[model samples]
Target: MASYWRTPKPGRKIPFIKKSPVENPIMEPSIPTHFRCPISLDLMKDPVTVSTGITYDRHSIETWFEVGNQTCPVTNNVLKSEELIPNHSLRRMIQDWCVANRSLGIERIPTPRIPVTPIQVSELLSEIASASRRGDRARCRELVAKIKALGRESERNWRCIVSGGAGRVLSASFSELAAGSFDNSTSGVLEEILSALAACFPLDEEAHWHIGSPESLNSLVLILNCGDLAGRLNAVLMLKELVSSLDADRINVVADTDGLIEALVKLIEKPISPQTTKASLVTTFYLASSSEMTAVKFVEMGLVSLLLEILVDSDKSMCEKALAVLDGVLESKKGRETASDHSLAVPVLVKKMFRVSDMATGFAVSALWKLCKNYEQERGEGCLVEALQVGAFQKLLLLLQVGCTGTTKEKASELLKLLNGMRGRGECIETVDFKALKRPF
Candidate 1:
C-alpha cells in the first residue's frame, strides 16, 4: 500500500498548495425596533406617546413643539393636542434591554423623572398669591419654597415655571414688598423673593421693568449691605441683570442710590466668594459705563484699590472685567488720579499687558495710555519716567511684537512712539535698557 503521506526528499523541490483566506463575519448587536425614537432614530430614555399615537423621546417631542412643529413627524397629520403621555411600558422595555446588554457596554437608564406640569405651577402661584394677600409670612414662605423647589428640580421645570408666569409674579411680589415699609423682621421674605428671582434667571423684560424701579433697586442694595452670603449673592446677581438691561436714565438712578456704590465696594473688599466678587465687578462696570457721573461715583467710592487687589489675585476672566471697570473709571480725571496713587497701579498695568488675554491687554494698555496722555503734558517727565520705571516700554514692545487686536496694536504703537520720543528727547530722566526689556522665550 502506498503511504498516504510522503516525506519530501531532502533538498528536492516540493509541490505546495495555496489556500484562500477565510474571514470571520462581524456581528453587530441588533436593536429592538420599538426602542428607537422615530424623530431622533436613537434609543429612547424617556418615551412619550403624542396625540397622533406616535412615540418619541420626551426631549425630542418637546423640541418639536418648541420649533413650532404642530404635526406628527411620522404621519404629517395635524396634532389635535400637544399633550405628551408618558409611554411607561416602552420605557420599561428599553430599560430592561439596557440591563440585558450590560456586558456589551450598554448602561442601564435611570428611572425617568417627572417634570413639573403647567397646572401644578399655576396652583403654586395661586397659593402664593393667596398667602401674600393675607400677609401670612409663614404660609408665603412655604409656598415660595415650593416654587423654588420646582425651579431647582430641573431645567424643564424652570421653563414651566417661567412659562406659567411665576417669574412675573415673583418680580411683582418683590416690587410690592420693596415698596412697602420693610424692617429687619421681613428680611426673610426678601431673601426668599431674591432667591426665587435668581433661580428664575434671565427674567423677562416685563420682570425687568418691575426690578428696575427705584424702590426695587434700593431694596436690592439694602440686601447687599445686610443680607447673608446667599441672599447677598442673589441680590447682587439680580442687580447685575437689572442694571445691565436698564436704560441710561435708570442706570443713573441706580448710580445715585445712597450706599449703592459703597455696598458693591464692600462686597469686593470682603468677598464671600469669587462669584460674588465677579458679580460686584460686573455691576460696577455696568454702572460706570452708563455715564460720566456714574464713573465718577465709582472713583469716589474708592474702587481703584479694591480693583487693583482683585486684578492681582483673580483669574483671567476676573482680570478682564476688573480692567474694563478700571478703564471706565480712568475716563475721569479724578479716576486717573485715584489709580495713579495706588502703589501697584503702574506696575500692575504693565505686567498685565501680555500676561492676560488680548481684551485685557487692550484695557491695560488703554488705561496706561490714558494716564500717560492725561498727565504727560501737565506732570511732564514725571509720568513718563514712572511708566519707564515700571517696564511699560518693554511690555508695549512685547505687545506689538506678539500682535494683538488691530485697535490694540494701533494703541500700543502710538504709546510706544510717544514713550520712545520722550526718551530720545531726554525728557525721561530715568534710563531704560531697551534690549533688556525684550522678554526671553
Candidate 2:
C-alpha cells in the first residue's frame, strides 16, 4: 500500500495552505407585527383608519369600496361610510422603524401628499368664472392650469373637482368661448379647459346632460374641428362619455350637430393614437346605432372606407369594433352602395370571417350575408363570381365545418346555398375543390 501511494520527494518544499477567514452572515431584522396591515399582512405604506377603527392600506380600502363591498374586511360589519381617515401616528411609527432598520435594506417612506379638497376646487372654479366674466384670459388660464394639476394628482381629487361643479363651470366657459368672437390669445385657455373636462372622473348623469346641451355640444364639435391635436383628443374623449350617458333624444341631437360626423371621420382618417381612434369609433358606433337616419348620415360621411382601412391594420379587438360599426352602417341603402363600391370591401369582409374572433366572424358573416342577399342579383352574377374568386366560398364552407357562433353557422350555411344556386353554368364553380374546404389550422 505504501509503495502504491507515492509520497513527495525528500528535497521538495511543502505547499503552504492558507485558510480563508470565516464570513459572518448578515441577518435581516424582523418586521413588527403592528406595522403590518390586517388585510394584506404587509407593511402599510399609506395606512388609513376606516369607520370600523381598523387600519388598512388606503388602496386596499378604496378597492374594497370600488368593488361594491360595503362591509369592513376585519370585522365584516356594515360600514357606515367609505370615509378613510389618515393614520398619521401609525405612519410615523412605521417610518421610524424603517429608519432604525436601514441596515436591513428597508426604504424610508416619503410623506404622503394630501389630496385637494372640494372647497379648494370650488374656489378655483369661482376664480375661473370670474376671470372668464372679466375677459381676463391670462387669469383664467392660470386658474385652469391649477385645476388641471389638482385633477391630475389623484382620482380622489378628480371626484372632488367634479363634485364641486367643475363640469358645469367648464361647459359654460366653453359655450361662452364658442358664442363669442374668436380670439387667438384665448384659444390656449379653451384647450386647457377641454383637457380639464376630459380629465374629470366619469361624469354623473347631471353632468352628462349639461355637456350634451345644445351650447356645450356645438362648442365640442367646434373644438373637434379646429382645436390642436391635444384639444381634439380630449374633445373626442368627452364626446364619447357624453354620448354614452345621453338618452335617445340627446343622441339625435349629437347626430344632427354640424361637422360632428365629419370631424370624427377626419379623426379616423388621421389618427393621433390608437386610443383616440378607438374612442372615435366607439362614439360613432353609439351614435349610428341610435337610429336608422343616424346610420345613414354616418354612411354619407364616407365612413366605410375608413372602417375598411382600420380592419386592414387593426388587431383582434379593434377588428371586432370595426366589424360592429360596419354592421350598423350596412343597415341603410347608402351604406351598402358605398361598401360595394369599394373594390377591397367584399374581399376584406370575407377574409375577416375566420381570421379574427368569433364575434368578428359573426359580424363579418352578417355583413356579407346582407350584401349578398341584397345586391347579389343587382350586381348581375359578377359579385358572386368575385366572392368565389377571392376564396369566399371556400372560407364560408370552412366556417361551417369548424366551431363558430350559431348565428355565424346559420349565415354561412345560407350564403353557401345561395352561392351554389347562383353558380349554375359557371366554369369557376366546376373547377372549385370542394374537398379542400378544411380548417386552416
Candidate 3:
C-alpha cells in the first residue's frame, strides 16, 4: 500500500513520499574544504568555534577538551576560555550543500543546539523540586520531559544537566512515583525519569545516595521484572551506577532488598543488549561482594550456572565481566562449592586466561585459585587432576611469561605449583623455573 504524509496545516495537500522498503544508499559527496572541521577533517555536523577561533566538530573538540587538552588542535594555542560558540554560518552552508546534493542521497545536517548553562539547568531543577513539594505529578513529569530533551540534545547539554544536579532531582521525582503512583498512565513518566537519570552519570556523591535510596532501588527492581526492554535496560544501567557508587554496607542494604537479586539475575538469564547484560553483571558483582549472605543468595538463584554459561559462549567484553562477577561470587563458601561442582567452571576459567585481557586474566586466576585451592583441601587431589586434564598448568605458565598484574601473577604461581605437583612436573615459583619446565613434563 502507498503511504502519504500530510502537512501540519490540515487544509494543505498530502505529499506522497512512499516510504522505501530498503534504506536509501548513502553516497559521499565532495564537501567544500571549508565545510570540514579542522580537528575531525569531516564535513562538520555541528560546527562550533572554540576560544582559539578555530572551528571544529562539536563532538570532536569536546572530546579533545575532555581528555585534558586545553590548547587548540590546529593552532596549539592555549584556550583562554572553554566556551563553544555555534558556527551557525558554516553549518547553514553545509546544510545547503547537503540539500543541493540531495539527489545523490546526502541528508541535510541538523541545526546545532546550544547547551544550557549551569544556571539555567539549576533553575529548572528548582522548579522540579517545587513541583515535588506541591505533590504535582503532572507538572513534575512535564518539567522532567524538558530536562530529558535537553540531555538528548548533545553531550555538553547532558554534562550541564548532570553537573547541575539532574540525577538528584530526577531520582527524587522517581521516588515520588515509587510511592504507589505507578500505573498505565504514568509508565511513560516512569521510563522518562529513569532514562533521564541514566544519562546523568558520573554523579556527585550526594546525588548517588538519592538515586540509591531503598525506595528508588525497589522501584527499579519492579521495572527490571516487568518493564519493557528499553525500560529494563535503563533500569539496569541506573542500577549499575547506583551500585558503583555504594560501599559494602550500602551494597548490603541493596542486597537485602526483596526481589532485587532475582530481578538482576533474570537480566543475565535473558540477554538483552550487551550493554544491559554488562550492567547487570556489574550490579551483581557489587551485591556478591557485599557479604556472604548476598553471595549465597546469588548462588542459590542459580547465578553460578548462568555466569558459567556466559563465560563459555560470550565475547571478550562479556567474558571479562563474567569472570569478575564469578571471582566476587567465589568469596563465599556456597559460591565456591557451586562453581567446583559445575563441570565447566575450572576448565572455562583456565581457558579465559591470557586470551581476554589483563583484568580478565586477573579475575580468572583469582576465581580458579579459590575454587581449586578450596577443593584441594576439601575434595583431595581430584580437582588438581581435573586442572591438569584441562591444561591449566600450561595456560598459567604462559600467563606469567606474557606478564600479568601482581595479584594475578601471585595466584597463577600458586595454581602452577599445585598443578605441577599433581603432574609430577617440577617447577619452582620463579619465572626461570617456568621457562625450564619445557623439557619433558
Model 1 lDDT per residue over 273-373, tens place = 99998999999998988998888877887788888987887799899999999988988888887877777888788888876888898999888888777
Give the per-residue lDDT of model 2 (tens digit) for 328-408. 888877787788788878889988987688899999999988777765445556556667767777788788778666788
Better of 1 and 2 by lDDT: 1
Off by over 4 Å in 2: 1-28, 49-56, 61-85, 118-140, 162-169, 247-249, 290-301, 405-410, 425-441
Q: By summed lDDT, which 10 consecutive residues of candidate 3 come out lowest? A: 15-24
Task: Assess every candidate by TM-score.
Answer: 0.82, 0.78, 0.75
Q: Model 2 — which ten-residue stretch has the worst lDDT? A: 1-10
Model 3 agreement with the true structure over 1-441: per-residue lDDT tens digits: 122222244343322212322332354566676787666566789888977788988887766666566677778887776778898888888998999999887888888667788788999999988887676777877998899888787777887788677877877777766665567545666777887877777667776776677767777788888788999999888878877878898888878888999998988998878899999999998889889899999999999999999888888889988999999999988888888888999788878886688888889889989887866456666667777877788888888887876887888899987787787633323444466566673
Global lDDT scores for all candidate models: 0.80, 0.78, 0.80
Ranking by TM-score: 1, 2, 3
- Deviation in angstroms for 62 in model 1? 1.8
